[model samples]
Target: MKNKKEMAKEIIALVGGESNIDSLIHCATRLRFTLKDQSVAQKSELGKLPGVLTVVETAGQFQVVVGNTVGEIYKEIMEQTSLGEGESSDKGSRRSKGSFLEKAIDVVSSIFSPIIGVLAGAGIIKGILLILTQLELLQKTTGTYQILNAASDSVFYFLPVVLAITAAKKFGANQMVSVIVGLSLLYPGLVTFMASGEPITFLSIPVLSGTYASTVIPSILAVWVLSHLERLLTRIIPDVLKLLLVPAISLSVIVPLTLLIFGPFGIYVGNGVSSLYNSMYELSPLIAGLFVGGGWTILVMFGLHKVLVPIGLNDIATLGSTTIFAFAAPANLAQSGAALAVAVKLKNKEMKSVATTASLAASLGITEPAIYGFNLKYKLPMIVAVISA
Candidate 1:
């Protein structure tokens, strides 16, 4: 509320001032930095900063989770600090692999970093729709309901596009090309082609047993393959024509392959996963809950969650119900409980301040900082919450 400038300077001073940092950037809710020396970072003071949540040193970066206000604070930090120009990425490694403590922090940061922002958007819209529907402001018969539903749903409806864009970058592929590949599977002709009345078979194999829209793994897998193809093309193509030739060839080869092999298989795999999940739920709702509810935070914290998201969406698309979504609800509920527990347990005044903020975030089902910085490190309370659920 005080704006980014005032609070950032206070944090800059706390974390050994601007002098201790080498570079900085931010995501939706975290100020990620590289510090001159971990020893100099005044974690205690940083925790006391007005807007600061907590200082996290993990994932080869110094992280300050600022909830929704991070981007503004990041700009302020960039403006006030004399961090050097764009330089080489300083990839850091922790003390030892044998340490379970280090591995736990690594897992938490790894899982939560990328997925949190998009999840917040989706959750907010969903929450808003829930509010409107309860208030009777969005009637089922009205356009308001349809429009708001579209807003609430597209994140899950056309999720493959979002996954494609992010996963391509994750896999070191050209994002635009990867997005093109993802969208192509949704093309009207392609949908019609796959669902055609004619019996289409390739080498005695059915062309497509399922649709690819809103899927997760296939587009990502295709991009991974395309990235290698791009790298290989990079080696052979003349430097003069590399830019043009690379895209042309990559698209030409990748698109066909994606359609022929990747799209169909990705759809099949996604469908198969849903089928497996359906069987699980039919046997025992509690077992289904145990997998998704107990493991949701763990999965969301790690990049692996992206793999299951498509199946959840696929179930909604095809079957009109999703057990994974139902399961995810309990995990979030447990996260809120664990966050409240941590807020009660931490004694350091600075840590207390961060815990208070994180408790609020978790109550709203935004647990990135709580998971990445505190609950994960402390380990016991978080694990208890998941296991209890």
Candidate 2:
């Protein structure tokens, strides 16, 4: 295989050179690029690259699918270019102005993508710790176990702060000020007061008491508001005092509003979305299972699959476990099994090799390579995979 640096250079050249790129970021799997001229990138050529699994264009990004090695590729890509500034404006871009759903997906994906690895790691540790404690292999009361448990829980506990910083970047808000707001949510005094169960009142209006830790919606919504407020403050505040006043004024206005309005509103929104999903699942477990299982790959094809991540995470945060990801387990099995079948039947050596590798990758729970690289290329296999799912 080519070194990552070489692959990065080739990929860069294929994506209309470095100059066409407005911003570049990598999720767990794909290298997401916001290009100045989308038309200039050679999508097909990029997909044909040795290390690349496929190329996907959706959610306002020229997404190059590199599978799990995307982080290493991203590092190489960064080293090769000066596109690390992370300027995400669409100024002079050819893509249409995004709809609300599109914008929301972009924001959500951007915020979650970078931190997902850490989140998953923390979750794994928590799961392992739970299992060990239940089995009596590890005593939960031990100092070692407590320290490890804290490590596992820290990510969720500080989720709002991380989300604040990431969302601020995505929404063009002041990052530090947004972080300050996030920090305020978890302030020791506030936590203490909240734990006391005493009523909180601002201007004689009672504050709804809720823990912001491990919640997704509140910080994201808060940052979205902060982005708009920052823009307004920047325009009105004088140049000399602009930096100082903008952050101060934005925080002063937003922090109170977040505690009073946005925080509870976001929780309500999460509950509503969760409720709708639960209602759907309850209405027809079989059909819902079939639809999610059968069309899982199709959803990923259109970039709609990411909508489930937050839902699943939210469910875990609120309800301790999720039903959503259960459907995906079967989907992965069906697709990988089909890919393996195709690999066994294929005549071409190259096709057979790719199919075999993709099949193994899919069985290991990374299905993009198999789905995009093997199944989709031979339409019959992809169809059979969906049917089998």
Candidate 3:
């Protein structure tokens, strides 16, 4: 196998060198690049690299699949090239523009990718705590239980604040100002005031009463608006006064706007989507199950699966659970089973090794290696996996 540096170097060259890259980021298993000229990228050659699993071009990204080592590989690429981590020197002007759906997926994936690992860890802790309490192994009234519960719940409780930092990065807005916008939504005083059952107003405009903790859409929408407001402020405000006025003006304007408009609007949108999904599920569980089970991997292939994360998160926040993961779990495990079958029957040593490792990863709920590196490569396995799922 090639070393990380060598692999990174080869990848940079194959993607039309450093100059062609407009920006770069990575998810759990792929190096996603936005290129200035997609035609110049050597996609087939990138797939042939030793460490590379495959290459996929979707959602206006040239994605190089490299399994779990994607983070380290991304680090090596950043170290060896001029490309900034998740930021472009060109400010995205030269990058390929995708359709509205593609742009939405790109934005959602980029905002969530950096935080998914910690969110999953917190979720696991919560699950374990729940199990312990259910089994009578731990008392919810104990100090230890209280501390652990806080640790697990903090992520969700402060989700809007965390999402603000990431959404600011994705939208190229002022991070601190974005954080302030998120914080205002969850401020203790405001929470108390809103919960008081009295009317709330900002400069005579009525503010909607709603909870923002553990919610997803409001922070993102707020930061997206902040990005544009910052740009306008930057242009109109003098350089000498920018440092002082920009943040102050942004917060003063955005906080009220978020309270009066974005926060309520986002909550409504989230509730509407959740209700729509529930109605679909209520209409026919078997059909919904069949489609999500069979087509979830297909959505992943096109990078559209990320579009569902917010919906699932919103459902969890509102409804306490979601059906998406319930259906997806079977699809993932089925792919693992199919890959194991391929591993057992394959005569070629190299292909067999890939299948074996990919199968193990898929069983642990990381199915990209299995889907792209094994099952999808062998058409029969993929078809069988989809049917079985």
Candidate 4:
């Protein structure tokens, strides 16, 4: 395989040079680029490059598939370029790049991508804890179990804080200020007060503070609003006072606004979405299964699969298990099977090798390689996989 830096340099050139890049971010397996001119990207050449699995353009990102080495490749690219993380230079081109929903999906994927591994680890630990307690092998109250449980639970419990930092970056807010806002929501004293079931007031006005931990929508909305408020304050506040005064004014206004408005609004919105999904599930689970099974990989193709992650996480946190991942599991397996079949049928040695690798990756729970690299590009196999799913 080529050196990561060599690969990065070639990839950058193939995507119409560093100048063509509007913004760049990476998920577990792909480097997503918002390019100034999508037509300039040499997608076929990029796919053929050493160490690259495939190239996909969807959800407003010119994505280069690099498998496990994506992080290193991303790091190398950043080291070689003036475009720092969370900083975009192609504002003029971005406005015309994609639809609002596509842009929204891009933002969501970028925000959640960095934290997925740890979140998955926490979820796995939570599952193990449940099994141990259920099997009576370990008591939940024991200090050993308690500590391990905290390890499993802490990620979700303080999810708002995690989301805050990432969301702030995506929304172009001050990350430190966003962290402060997140911490304020999860302040120990506030949590205690909410636990005590006491009526809450902030500055003599009634405040509706509740659990902010393990929630997604509220923190994202709060940070978005905070970003605008911060910008406004930055403009009006004197430069001499900007650093100190801006944060003070922003946080003071934001914290109360969040408590009175965004926090409860998010809770209600989340509840409504969960309830609606549950209702759909109840109406006809088989139909729901078929719907997700047939459409899940397609959803993934457009990067819309990320929308399900928070919902699945919330479901696991709230109900102890999730139906979303379960529904998609068969789809993943189907893609694996289809890719393997294609590997056997293909004549070219290189294509066969790539297909085989993708099949293996998909079987092990990473399907992007198989889906984007081969299956989705070939209409028949994609249809077959969806039907099998």
How many collisions between residues are there in candidate 1?
A: 3
Q: Largest TM-score belongs to which candidate?
A: 3
Q: Single out the weakest 10-residue window by summed lDDT for candidate 4.
A: 87-96
Per-residue alpha-carbon lDDT of model 2 for 115-135, expressed as tens digits?
877877787798799999999
Off by over 4 Å in 1: 1-64, 73-116, 123-141, 199-206, 272-280, 290-311, 334-360, 368-388
Q: lDDT at 334 for candidate 3?
A: 92
Q: Order candidates by TM-score, high to low.
A: 3, 4, 2, 1
Task: Compose the digit string of candidate 4's lDDT tens values, residues 1-389.
Answer: 89988988998899999889877888778888889899999988988897887777887888887886789999999998877944521221234257987877787887898887788677678778889999999998899899998997898888989999988877778889888888888999888998897888877888775778788878888998988888788778899999799889888988888888898998888877877887899999988898887889888776677888888766765676778888988998999999999899999999999899889978766788888778877878889999998
Give the Å shift of residue 81 in candidate 4: 0.9
> Model 1 compared with the native: what TM-score?
0.66
Q: What TM-score would you give candidate 4 relative to the actual structure?
A: 0.89
Q: Show the lowest summed lDDT stretch of 10 residues, model 1.
A: 87-96
Q: How accurate locally is residue 293 in candidate 1, as Cα lDDT from 0 to 100? A: 80
Candidate 3 lDDT tens digits, 74-180: 99999998677545212422424779877767888888878777777788799899999999999999999999999989988899999999888777888888888
List, residue by residue over 69-155, the lDDT tens digit for candidate 1. 786777777778755333211211112132575444433333234555665577578778789889987777788778777876776
How close is every model to the real structure, measured as TM-score?
A: 0.66, 0.88, 0.94, 0.89
TM-score of 2: 0.88
